[model samples]
Target: MLDQDTPHAAMPGLEIPESVAAALSGWVQQVAEQTAGPVRAALEQLESEAAELRDTGAELEAARDQALAASSEHQAEIERLTVELRDARKLATEALVSKAKDQLAIDGKDRQLADLRTQLERNVAAQGSESDARLAAEMELVGATTARDNFEAEVRTLRGQLDKSYAERSALRAELETLRGKK
Candidate 1:
């Protein structure tokens, strides 16, 4: 019986059967498999070649895994940057809209201020004309009052001259009557 750790053909000083050795030799010659005069030599060469091929396959698998990891990392970074860019654009648009609304409100307030100023100026102008008319009416009233006072003074002086003329005429008539009584 062959142990799991030791092959039967690898034991030193062990003799193989004549029929098994003849059959192995004939198969090696038929297949043209090269060996170091022992059937184990060909098997060792085949195992070395298989090990080298497994090492190459392992190296290729590791490279493929690394490439996939790098690609995934790049994709994650791109997605994060895309989300950040979208947020920035949305904030900028909102800021612009708010600024536009504020500007329009300011423009409306400015127009209202201009209209108020114009209305105040028109009211002042109308008041200026009313004040001028009031002053002219007062000046005419003063002129008429002065003329009436001068007319009253002239009428009083004329009545005093008429009374003095009547007294002079009565004295002259009495002197003539006395002269006639003396004759």
Candidate 2:
């Protein structure tokens, strides 16, 4: 038991005895241990949860980095494919232009062939007209030659008849003169 009139019980100039101070310190330590046990367990559980959360965050960050890398690779591939597609379009356009030019050349050739065919047909027709004209002229020449040869033969026959008549006349005259002299 403590004396109530002790200086330690007074508000000022208080001094505690060594035995009671030690007993009070021991009781305070026991009460602190008893009250802090559940708090410590809870703090440990929170710290462990925080460590797990940090690990999960690191994993998420790594996953995000991998996703970003994959996205960058996909973007580069898309760009490359776009360039290839543009080149392909350019090639296709060039091919189309070349084909159009070739078609134009072929059309020109076809026109030239058509013109040549027309000229050949005209030449053949002109030659046929010339051949017909030449054949007609040759027939006229042959008719004229046949008429000249018939006229020459008729003149020769008339000359031969005239000679025969003259010979007969001369023989008669001689006979008449001889007869008269004899008589």
Candidate 3:
């Protein structure tokens, strides 16, 4: 080990001339400068890549937020559609019930028409056998004819009612179909 205060005797018996020392120092500096340029460029490129990654992360976060908001809106729309569908189904059911009631009434009217026809036929057959009963039979026939005409008119009115009910039912069915198609 050499004394800290001594310069020329720093290393024993090792003398370096000023000119050769200066040349070695210059070569070391040149080598350091060359290597530092590539190192600084690599550091700058790394920093640029890191900044890009941060931007990508932020964009991904924003996309996730938008998707969540869209999903929430779609869920709300689905709930609203479900309520509308239920209402349409209820209306369809009520229309079907009304149609059934109208059908029953028409059936009753048909039965009444059949009974009136049978009675008229029996009255006509009775009038053919006896002269004394013939006059009474003609009066009975007239009354039966009037009753038949009234019943026929009532049948026509009931048929009109049934037709109106059918129309209403058709309208309800069409509305239901429209609602379903929206889904």
Candidate 4:
């Protein structure tokens, strides 16, 4: 029991009534007993929630790592495919150029063949003209041959006349010689 007559120990900046202090002490003890069970239960619930949060954080980190790895692999694949596509495009361009060159060569050959055909036609026409000239010359030669045959027959007749005259003159000379001898 506290002595009322003695100086009571006072908290700094607080006045206490005897009856109120006794009632406050009783209230503090009653509240401590009443709240102990619920407080322990609330602390346990908080601890469980914290543990679950830690586990969820670890799982989230693993998921993030897996996603990053998949993304990196996908990027690598995209790069490889891009290179392949570039090579294919290059090959296609070369093939197109080659085909164009081949087509140009074929066109050039066709033009040459056309020119040759034109030259051949001109040559054939020239040959035909030569053949016509030869045929005309042959006809002229045949007419000349007939004229030559007629001229040769006339020359033979003239030679026969000369031979007859020569024989008459020889007979006259012989008669003159016989008369002289008789005289």
lDDT of each: 0.57, 0.62, 0.61, 0.61
Model 3 pairs in collision: none
Give the Å error, residue 46, model 3.
Answer: 2.3
Tens digits of per-residue lDDT for model 4, 136-160: 5555555555545555554455445
lDDT of 1 by residue, 97-124 (tens): 6556645654565565556556758776
Compare the candidates by lDDT and give the number of the best one: 2
Worst 10 residues of 4 by lDDT: 174-183
Q: Model 4's lDDT to the true fold? A: 0.61
44-145 per-residue lDDT for model 3 (tens digits): 999999999788767656655665555565556555555555555555555555545544654565565556556657787643433444444455556555
| Clash number by candidate, in order | 0, 0, 0, 0
Weakest lDDT window of 10 consecutive positions for candidate 1: 174-183
Which window of ten consecutive residues has the lowest lDDT sum in model 2? Answer: 174-183
Candidate 1 is scored at a TM of 0.39
Candidate 2, 7-102: lDDT as tens digits: 675467669999999999999999999989999999999999999978876766665566556556555655665565555556556655655665
> Model 2's lDDT to the true fold?
0.62
Q: How close is each model in CA RMSD to the real structure? A: 55.5, 54.4, 16.7, 54.4
